[model samples]
Target chain A: MRVLGVDPGLTRCGVGVVEGVAGRPLTMVGVGVVRTPADAELGQRLVAIERGIEAWLDEHRPEFVAVERVFSQHNVRTVMGTAQASAVAMLCAARRGIPVALHTPSEVKAAVTGSGRADKAQVGAMVTRLLRLAEPPKPADAADALALAICHIWRAPAQNRLQQAVAQHALKGPIR
Target chain B: MRVLGVDPGLTRCGVGVVEGVAGRPLTMVGVGVVRTPADAELGQRLVAIERGIEAWLDEHRPEFVAVERVFSQHNVRTVMGTAQASAVAMLCAARRGIPVALHTPSEVKAAVTGSGRADKAQVGAMVTRLLRLAEPPKPADAADALALAICHIWRAPAQNRLQQAVAQHALKGPIR
Candidate 1:
């Protein structure tokens, strides 16, 4: 399966596309960042990010999209921008009928480096080695996005099974 | 001018439309909420919000969209969802080239009730009085949205003049 992972931000949104499934080698299709000027209006910045993600979706045609699930940050403004950009990415995927998965930062790190507490450099090295790249993707955000794609590709099957089980249990109605 | 105000939320997004310019009486064009169940997936909920806002914009054809700017809340999850929903509202307006404005919660309250610290009941009471409603809009969110629209209609002219002045000053190329 092909997945496009988004590391969402207002000023710089990182995008990476990977092709693979679990128990197989993953290939990097593309990686880049979409940037909007800091001076731009919030709405304009969001529009730019939306257009960028739409262009990537059109070009890559990934079957699934993975976005970083935003948690709290010390800086409220930063967290707000990240959350906004994340929503734009999900909206683009939903508009294109692509399934979207959200991976937490620790989840991505754990999947890529076998340690939830792995540092950025460790995750970056793992991504480079796993994807067999000549060098690690620059600007941290790019490497983070690749990690998210890898994480989603590895976790989706099991997650899908869990979702199915929940659905089945719901259909069976509450314990009476 | 006509304005559509959006009080964004994941579970229940409030929408209100009003028609008028500064120094003139405003008319209530419409008021409602777009609800998505809490049990729905996040992406699905966002998509539902996008669709709801799009439908409102298409039907009302508002000249401007006023969204409540998200602020940091004690509850991180609540703030994140509000930010996401706000982005969706702004995107709908930006897509259609309708001017978008953001009003703070305090600004909305102050505009309608003459105090930034006014409580919800005070704002609701003022909204009812201003709109000549027999009773305040239900669910508080709807009233808050109307207050936002009213605030924008009142504030937009001065804000535009200020923006124009800044642009003009910048064009003159920094004073020697």
Candidate 2:
């Protein structure tokens, strides 16, 4: 399964593509960050993100798009930007019929490093080792994006099945 | 100046259009809520919002889009949804080359009512009076949407000039 992971942010959105099933070794197809100017208006920044994510989708054509689920952090303003960027990523994928999955920061860390509490350096080191790359992806955000894809790929088979069932049910009609 | 105001929400996105400029009687061109299933996936709901906003833009062809600015509050989850929805609204407007403006809830209240701390009912009543409506728009969100348009229209003329200068500078290139 080819999956694209996105660590969404306004200043630097990280994107990475990983290809392979859960059991087999995964191949890193690409890794990069989409950066927008800090001083730009909020609306223009979002439009830039949409264009960036759309370009990635057009190039990689991943079967699934994995995005880091945003949570309320102490920095409310920063969190709002993250939430907005993530929305753009998901919208781009969903528009093209690509399945989108959301994984928490801790979940991505646990998937790469043994512990959910692992720090960024540890997660980056493990990602480098797992992907057999000469060095870790730069900007930390890029590494986190790859981790999100790894987490989605490593998720239990049963969980994926349940998610598929939910997606199918959603298509049937509105639950309300 | 024709303005389309959006009160962005995942479940019920309120949209209203007002035509005319400051110091003149404003006309209510349209008002309604875009409802999406509560149980839908986040990406799907965003897509629905984009479609709804697009339809409104097509029908009204407002020169400016005014959206309520999202601020963090006690409810983290709800605030994230609001931020995301606002992002989508802004994106739709920006993509079409229509200028988008953001008005805080307090600003909207102050523009229509004498006080910024006015309650929803008070704001609604004032909106009805300002627009010469027979009754307050249904659903508090719809009224709030109109208030946003009114607020944008009533912003100090100097501020609009400053904003236009900044927007023009942004088009030149990345400030950073």
Candidate 3:
């Protein structure tokens, strides 16, 4: 399976594409950042993000798009921008009928580094090792995006089964 | 001037269009709410918001879009959705090169009711009176949207002059 991961932010949105499935070696397809100037208007920034994300989707054509899930509990000032940027990523994917998945930061860390509480350096190191890159991707955001893509590819099978089970249960009606 | 105002939310995004300038009676061009199912996935909800906002823009062809400024200090659960929705609104306008303006809740209230702390009812009442509506628009969101359009109409003149002054000042040498 091919997946595109997005580490969303207003100033610099990280994007990474990976091709693989669970229990297999994954190959990195592409990785980059979408940057908007800080001095631009909020609307302009969002428009720029939309354009950048669209360009990625157009080139990669991944089966799924994975984005870092935003939590309001994070830094009060930055969380809003993160949420807004993620929304744009999701919207772009959804508009094209591409499936979008959100993985928590901890989930990405745990998936790659085997620990939910791993530090940035640890996560970056693990991502480098897993992707067989000579070195880790820069700016940390790029590494996080690859991590998210890896997590989604690894987890999607079990997640699909769980969703199917729930749907089947719903069809069976309430358990009285 | 024609302005489309948006009271942004995931479930119920309110929109209104008003025409005219400050010190003259404004005319209500349109008013409505765009709703998405609460049970839908977050990505789907955002897509619905984008479609709704785009439709409004296509129909109204307003010169500007005025959206409520979201604050992280608001209810944590809802604030993220508000910010996301507002981002979509701004994105739609900016993509079309229409200017987007943000008005805070207090600013909207103060512009219409002469009190920043005015209750919802007071703002609605004043909106109805100013628009010469038979009654206040239903759902506080819709009323607030019209209020935003009016606020922008009244404030845009002074805002343009201030922006121009700042631009010209930059062109000249610093005061020091």
The runs of at least 3 residues in candidate 3 whose Cα sits more than 4 Å from the true structure, single-residue gaps closed, are A159-176, B156-158, B161-176
Sort the candidates on TM-score, descending order: 2, 3, 1
Q: What TM-score should be assigned to candidate 1?
A: 0.90
True contacts kept of each: 0.61, 0.63, 0.63
DockQ of each model vs. true complex: 0.39, 0.51, 0.39
Q: Model 1: runs farther than 4 Å from truth?
A: A156-158, A161-176, B159-176
User: Best by TM-score, which number?
Assistant: 2
lDDT of 3 by residue, B1-176 (tens): 89999999999999999999889999999999999999988889999999999999999998878999888988989998998999899888877767788899999999999999999999999999999999999899999999999999999597745543443343243211
What digit string (tens of lDDT, one per residue) describes model 1 on residues A46-70? 8999999989998999877899999
Instruction: List candidate 2 stretches off by more than 4 Å.
Output: A159-176, B161-176
- Residue-level lDDT of model 1, residues B1-84, one tens digit each, is 788999999998999998877887788999999888898667677888888999999899998899999887657769999999
Q: How well is candidate 1 docked (DockQ)?
A: 0.39
TM-score of chain B of 3: 0.90
Measured by DockQ, the strongest candidate is 2
TM-score of each: 0.90, 0.92, 0.91
| Residue pairs with clashing backbones, model 2 | none
Give the interface RMSD of each candidate.
5.8, 2.2, 6.4
Q: What is the TM-score of chain B in candidate 2?
A: 0.90
Error of 1 at A121 (Å): 1.4
